[model samples]
Target: MLWWGKEMNEWQVLHASDLDFLLENSSSPYDYSGDNNESEYCCGTPPCSQDFTFDRTFLPVLYSLLFILGLLGNGAVAAVLLSQKAALSSTDTFLLHLAVADMLLVLTLPLWAVDAAVQWVFGSGLCKVAGALFNINFYAGALLLACISFDRYLSIVHATQLYRRRPQARVTLTCVTVWGLCLLFALPDFIFLAANHDERLSATHCQYSIQQVGHTARALQLVAGFLLPLLVMAYCYARILAVLLLSRGQRRLRAIRVVVVVVVAFTICWTPYHLVVLVDTLMNMGALARNCSQENHVDVAKSITSGLGYMHCCLNPLLYAFVGVKFRERMWQLLIRLGCPEQREHVRQLSRRDSSWSETTEASYSGL
Candidate 1:
């Protein structure tokens, strides 16, 4: 992985046509390549050692914290949403599914944590399952956020009539469609990812078997998982912002804050990772020149940024659900029922204060 000089250039020159073809057909300017699988190869140059000391030290702790925080946050979201006897709003339904997606994503983290600290101890079958689940939920969470944004756009800007009647059915269909798309995106991982021993790393690792398959997977991830959903969110939020701005009130201000916070949080958590991965992808695809130093820099950056990206799963509940008056109220009620009877009056007062902020906002938004 560290040796990227003359031999790497020769390989790039040999595969130049293939790389161009991939770039031409790819959906995003920045695509994902075999960043994860790069350590498996050594150009015909003298064997060079790529240090995984940072990965071993950093990743296990990162994944463990993410798993714990994500599990607790999404678990609370699911529990509160399910406990309610009332019919769910479109936003609520999406939040529930988003929680489920985040939960699924976090559940895979422990296995990955183990993989990072040691080696891929799980066999091939479990590796494939865990990898596929990771990919699916990674995309699903992003797409579901886009769905929430689009739903908000329709309700706030166009005020669509279709959602006014039998909205639950339509929401259900949308969630199903999103999951199906995510499954399709993860299909390559399900088929190709396996636990294999890497000579360079001298450890077993789970990654794509075929380099081309890794390129394809990365392309899909960058395009569909990141870019497509990013576009959808940007457009939806832009329109939602336009409508919110026209209204004159503190509610409008709070709604605007919600829009800003959601977009900013998503961008902050994900953009760096995607950009670093994109560079890795471009190098792998021969779209960019490769050097050992640059590759090593990206290797470390990818680890750091990917950990930041993983943190978004934990942030979802706080950003999308807990910030809302209704959801908070529900959570408080659940807590009170569970064991916080003494705080019931305090919860009611806090709920009433925030609930009065905006009736429409309460119904339309999960968070502010």
Candidate 2:
């Protein structure tokens, strides 16, 4: 889901021939008062004529790949999770919700993929729906990751079962609150996004369509979607690492490795996109000088980095679910119950081999 920046206010007043290049192709603020064929003046300087050939050819393929892989991975997670509803831990519950969020996020990809390759064939109403859906799930997924980190911190660092009593009620309440907050965050997308014809580009784009600085929405997303969750995960994982360091066991060592990988993978995937967003935010807020070259660079960087961010949905299942011994065992057991006799013996062997270490891992992170 692309976000609005301060320049949106100026874009609303632009003539059809002077409007930015295809807004649908960009994930950052659209460059206002520019034509694809000729440079136009904006911010007291001439804007660059951006060639979207790369975006048209590249983004669709990338989004399609992410959609297919994310669907299979997150779908397997959801299916396996639902089958074991009776034996879910707090961590399992969070994983289930995270999978749900990733699935929802990927479902919006086909529309966006189409938009990048072609244009907004879907009407303005569906545009708003797709944008809002993307915004909601994106924010919810990040927040749920933070919740998982906090739950891990409690389990490993504090060794407290805060949700042991009425766990379902507590977990449900927490997830519902996350969804509510995400819905609130998505309001601007529902309100400002629409399918509009860019005369210079000669295409209809589902993009932010208003004249407001819109810094509040950007700041909210930056903080709630990225910064706050990043801080929570960093602190929680750092504390958990400290506690694990004092212990001596193969399980502790394995848990430490998993924690390190999870944190590193997340940072690698998301930090670039948020950093680009932060730079764009500064540009929008006038804290940094804006130029045609810098704006073009930011837009290109946003596209590339945002693709990196989207891949995290595909990685979440591998990092958070498949990495856990208990989750794998449960999945194998579920397969055995579903008439997969081949997996029955495999499950037995796995259970026997992992019994001691798996229990400690579960006690430490509660089924990851």
- Highest-TM-score candidate: 2
Q: How many pairs of residues collide in each model?
A: 0, 0
- Model 1 off-target regions past 4 Å? 1-48, 255-260, 320-322, 366-368
Model 2: how far residue 32 lies from native, Å: 16
For each candidate, what TM-score against the reference? 0.85, 0.86
**What is each predicted model's overall lDDT from 0 to 1?**
0.73, 0.76
Candidate 2 overall lDDT versus native: 0.76
Q: What lDDT does model 1 reach?
A: 0.73
TM-score for candidate 1, residues paired by index: 0.85
Candidate 2 stretches with Cα past 4 Å from truth are 1-13, 16-44, 211-214, 253-260, 320-322
Candidate 1: tens digits of C-alpha lDDT, residues 1-368: 11111112223322345556645554533343446734223332433346668878998899889889999999998998888887777777887898899899989988888877788888889988888898899899889878877877777788764466788788888999999998988888778877766654567777776767776777777888888888999998888777766775557557545545766688789888888877887887778977677767877888888888889888867864645556667787889889989879978797678766656565456433
